[model samples]
Target: MHSLARRALHTCNVPRDLTQVTFCDSAGEHPDRVGLDGNAAEAVWRSVEALYRTGVHPGIQLSLRYRGEQVLHRSIGHARGNGPHDPASLPRIPMTTDTPICFFSASKAVTALLMHMLSEQGLVNLMDPVSYYCPEFARNGKRTITVHQILSHRGGIPAIPRETPIDVLWDRDEIWRLLCAAKPVEVDGAKVAYHAITGGFVLQRVLEKVTGDTIESYLDRYLRRPMGMKWFTYGIAP
Candidate 1:
């Protein structure tokens, strides 16, 4: 391991109370008694605990699994915040292994998986032009762009203009129109600039157009529901 990695691992010291951890098993066996190397497993726990103690990150919940067995499960710090540390001040909810946390841009993999599932089911083709499903995407010289290009971050529209309000990113129709009307920074499939957020909106619209269901609904039916995940969705209702 590099010095930096060693330093990080060494610096990660969790509070004594935070050390309470659990392991999930099929036959209700303890993780240590199951088959993982004790040192390796301890390292994973220490690393996750250390991340929570970094102070840069407010909280963390980490679970490691092998062959369908959760070998290590742990949570540390407050999901809300440390707050006043007094019961009278405010309620500081401590984070737990089962806490509902948002994945943010980490959600890209889930979105990508959804697209792959669609392709696997023969509902869409990765090689087909995106315009085949969402014809409006053909505007602004993007008629030649392929689904593979978008998935691989080669679809020219990595971002909307800087002046775009943060709120519009969630306004599906406005964001979609802007993306469709915008010109590519480079030729389709010629460069690999991660779309960051733009590609998700565009691809989501195309997905909805093709499947006749909202992206959220599609995910629930094809991914989350079957997998037994309840809280995973595009947005939380406030």
Candidate 2:
């Protein structure tokens, strides 16, 4: 093992109870069935530690696997600020291996995977126009915009207007209506620009339309539940 992995292995605070490790198979009961490079695994942990030490992030929870078998799992640091939510704060609630962290834009990739699953089930087609699943999406000359374009960042509707109320984001109906009625900034599929938040909203509606279920429900039934995840969901319920 590399020095990095050795240090990580020696210092890692793996919880005593196997059940406390999130994302571990059988709660980390089985040994490695396939050989994994201890050095490489250690390097991954060292990198996370270095980032935390450098103030890049306050804490990290990482899990690594090889050939479908977990090789290394570690979690370290605080969940929040010790001082008010200010820069001067030190550490607060200690983060555990199982602490639930928000994915933010990382959730986009998850949504994309969900879309692929729906496509594989033959309930949705990437090549089809967005309007095929949600007819309101056809407004403002968007009838020609394909799901493929949206996923690829070529749909041309990148942002809702600046005049849109900030609070409207939490109101799904208002956000959906704004996106459906909004015009493309350029010709659809003519260019590539990150859609940021708009793509997710449109995709959510499309997925719900095809699956007859919300994105959260579809993920729970097909993804999270099968994987044995206890708390993963699209959003926390109010």
Candidate 3:
């Protein structure tokens, strides 16, 4: 195995007992919520505890709602500084229910939902090529890639080129330019390679082009603000 892979495996093999030391419970749980009994809620929490004991994840947070009421809102382990590979001398930052965790790929689901919502509003048709909305994406033989293909991980451009700088991610225009210029592995939507980070930008561009607004503003106006979310955003606020 590669040295880094071996190190990663070793780091993930945390002792079961260490979970107890690292565990931090949030005070936000509402076991007494009318439909949920304390015992039933504890059963669910115990299941979460069992997963935590496996030590694969350094931290976890859960907010489970039952019938429109939040029955469980809790977190466990360290958000930082207590990874299995870290030395014991480091100070642990306790994971809390309020911790600003990155949704990462989970944001893709939200983006997908937004796309469906846009379709419902007659903003863009899912089956239409993305180039129909953002003509720049038509470059480099991507002219026929549909919004649906991108949403489903079938759009051919799965990743940015290896030679690209990591910092280019924050430069939206530059990243889009690279994506526009990238050759597709295939454009027939016959494969299932995941786009990972690339699809989000493509979807964002289409959304912005159709709405004449930034994706963030569109999300805020349609979903975040209306849903009363405190911090479900693309990036952390400074």
Candidate 4:
């Protein structure tokens, strides 16, 4: 395990979660396709073992969709713990198709999608001032900020002050208070900077007020359940 990981670390930057590790540096051949006529099972297990030798691995599923049909579906690596070793001290914990894994910040793209859909459907005007929808949000100097600015991450309070207590972030009232009092470090809508984490939460509240729906229900009814994408959330799932 140590030797395999040494090679992987030297070759690639596949960051591992010490408490929750997954596959490291999953790679493929240059041929673009792996034949599965016979010995397919052996090939799949070989790929799994190759990953285990490196370090802790996660289940990685690769599928090819063509003409509305899935031509190839491959599962590589185990879920959590080291499974079993081939000729070593450990074994490989093989992964199955039904095993669902946490898809982290990829979840935010879904939130962005919800905003896009609302814009396309004419339900939410992108230019509308957040203050227009949520009058209470006009406090401080934020009265003029637009939904476009917020979603595009130009809304004033881009940089939440560093001294904010990390524990209070989940406290809705405290979080809003910090954001409400924050001053914009950059001019709104000049150039663009990724507001990273703060923009999403602010947009969430504004979204809820305008649609008369929580971000989850608004996203799920119009985005997830309809679109058949279930691995989505704005915050922790209820």
Best by TM-score: 3
* Candidate 1 RMSD to the real structure: 5.9
lDDT score for residue 182 of model 4: 70
TM agreement with the true structure for every prediction: 0.75, 0.78, 0.81, 0.64
Every candidate's lDDT: 0.73, 0.75, 0.82, 0.60
Best by lDDT: 3
- Rank candidates, TM-score, best first: 3, 2, 1, 4
* Residue 37 local lDDT, model 1: 80
Error of 3 at 142 (Å): 2.1
The runs of at least 3 residues in candidate 3 whose Cα sits more than 4 Å from the true structure, single-residue gaps closed, are 1-34, 226-228
Instruction: Give the lDDT of residue 63 in candidate 4.
Output: 41
What order do you get sorting by lDDT, best first?
3, 2, 1, 4
The predicted structure with the larger lDDT, 2 or 3, is 3
Residue-by-residue lDDT tens digits, candidate 2, 2-110: 3354344443333334233223223552234575566777687667766554433556776665676666666666666522233434435666666788988889899
**Residue range with the least summed lDDT across 10 consecutive positions in model 2:** 16-25
- lDDT tens per residue, model 3, 115-138: 999999999999999999988899
Cα deviation of 17 in candidate 3 (Å)?
9.1
